[model samples]
Target: MIIITKNAKKYFNYLLNKKKIGTQIYLFINNPGTQFAECGISYYNNKQFSNDNIRIKYDNLFIYINKNHIIYFKNSKIDVIKNELELQLILKVPNAKKKIIKKNKILKNKIINVLNNIINPQLKQHNGYVFLIDITTNKDIILEFKGNCNGCSMSNITLKEIIEKKIKKLFPEINNVLDFRYYKKK
Candidate 1:
């Protein structure tokens, strides 16, 4: 239930008419590890639509949002504020703060359990182990490889093809499994 305030709706319609563009609008949570989750709007050209997204028609505009983010987006209200010279769109998301903290705890524990039970055991055979450094807001796993895995030639392949696949199979929310060693070498 995303509510576009009257002022914001009028402004949005004006911008669309003035530009004469036929692109759809996408509202999503951009969690780039900046300590706060931001509401981001994108002008989508339909080139990168996903089946996991929820499509909504509001007035003369179409909004696409990820299904996973719907919980935080519920009852969100968008309003246009004009201060002397510039106009800004302000989103009032009441439940987002609470949900963010709760979800992270749940996701982190689940990832840690998977790493201990499944992924680490396999790598242990090679006299290597991976430590979970952090989980990004985008659900990407950031791991630090230790022992033989730290500088192994097959680390990249192992992280992507094997570790990532296993984690993703268990938790669909998990994105990329990033090894810190690879980036440090680059």
Candidate 2:
């Protein structure tokens, strides 16, 4: 559920009455359910208008939010803060930073998730990153290295000792892990 505080309602009224804008505003979220989630407010242009947009009325104005975005807005509160000379809109969405995972996720997605959430952090320390490229019929995992690891002489050792071991350990079905730039399949 979303709550628009009294002060926030007043600010919305001010925006319509004093600013002479339309009676509609759009609530948006970018990269929802991730560590980098962000909430924003935007005005819809004529071309962007659609009757399908779900809206909630707040006396003087209406907030249009996509139905799918409601998940991130659960337990969300919209408020306003009055500073020295400015009124700032505050959006507190507690669930926005939580990662959403489905039970029936594919093997590729599962592997990518582990690489992104686990292995990439350690690689980032050395100014490098690795990502899955392909999974062969033989269950061989192909990975691409970037940044510092791309041309480094130690990449082969790193792949054998660190990346390969980790991938195989996490997903035991995986046969071999090969670096894309270094390993060319015949």
Candidate 3:
């Protein structure tokens, strides 16, 4: 949900009159949940509304939000600020760059537990270990290597052969198991 300031709502109405079609506004986020996330506002047309979007009636205008991008827009605010004779549309989106909660936490933790119980024991033999760093939305696993395995060239073989194979066996839904890269120890 987003809050439209009094001035912002007026500004939106101003834009609606200029549009040739529907009196609707669209809020969008590009590459959300990462460093490069960008939030934007645009004029929306009635013809574009579908199951992919959720609509909310705000005063005189309707707003549409993409169902997949709602997480980043939650609790956001839109305001029109005048500075140095210039009017700027400011978007205050907290969850855009900072995510509130991960998508699939239960599966992530389960993968970690599986790795900790089955994989770490063998890795500990080499004074090395692999732990889950993140689970991407695509179900690919991100892992970090520690101890002797951190800089070992054989780590790639361990990842693709042992780790990836075992995880794919347990969770057939998983796509890739990637190793997180960190600087070598001094």
Candidate 4:
């Protein structure tokens, strides 16, 4: 979501319309957290910079703002203060920062395709199904082993040696695999 202040709207529109060969503008809104408050307007051309909680990709020439940022600026008004020396976004709704998971659709579909075709087919003989629970940037693939494989004694070995190895071999990008099958608690 683009939060354009009344004062900055004109300039922002200009930037969006008259972007040069290699220039991109990104606005970052800080979330309310225990540690600190930090936000800035980032200017990029052709490089990627990532901080602790944010990442900017200049090649795309687009700012993929997070949900938290949007929520933070939802009730805020943007204005140019003090003869254009400073730009400010005033928050009308306090405590509006909400954290939410943002999923990459293309990557997710790619993972699901691989799982359905490769993993599930292989496990069909055991009446097992490989359900992908989640995928992380760290390349950890979380899966739930269902059917006969769920409570099997050798499930751990199957997951670690067989399933994990197969998945890693197929998708070299994955770093680790975790099985999240539900078992009776002792």
Top candidate on TM-score is 3
Error of 3 at 141 (Å): 22
Give candidate 4 regions above 4 Å deviation: 1-3, 6-103, 181-186
Candidate 2, residue 109: the lDDT equals 94
Number of the candidate with higher lDDT, 1 or 2: 2
User: What's each prediction's TM-score?
Assistant: 0.49, 0.49, 0.54, 0.46
Q: What is the C-alpha lDDT profile of model 1 across 69-143, one tens digit per residue? A: 777787989899999998988877765654345678788888889889998999999999998888887788889
Taking the tens digit of each residue's C-alpha lDDT, what string does model 2 give over 1-186?
Answer: 888999988887777675435546778888988889998887654346676567777776688888767777888898998899999999888988787653323778998999899888988998998988888878888899998878788889888998888888888888999888756766
Count of clashing residue pairs in every prediction:
0, 0, 0, 0
Candidate 4 weakest lDDT stretch, 10 residues? 52-61
Answer with 3 or 4, whichever has the higher TM-score: 3
Which portions of model 3 show Cα errors greater than 4 Å? 100-186
The runs of at least 3 residues in candidate 1 whose Cα sits more than 4 Å from the true structure, single-residue gaps closed, are 32-35, 100-186
Q: Write the per-residue lDDT of candidate 4 for residues 1-186, one digit (tens) a residue.
A: 234455565554456666655555555655543235455555555355444334433333354344446545444444445545654433343324444344554566777898798778878888987788877768788888888878788778888898789888877888878876542221
Which TM-score value belongs to model 4? 0.46
Candidate 1 TM-score, C-alpha based? 0.49
For model 3 the local lDDT of residue 84 reads 97
RMSD of 1: 8.9
Error of 3 at 182 (Å): 48
For model 2, the local distance difference test gives 0.81
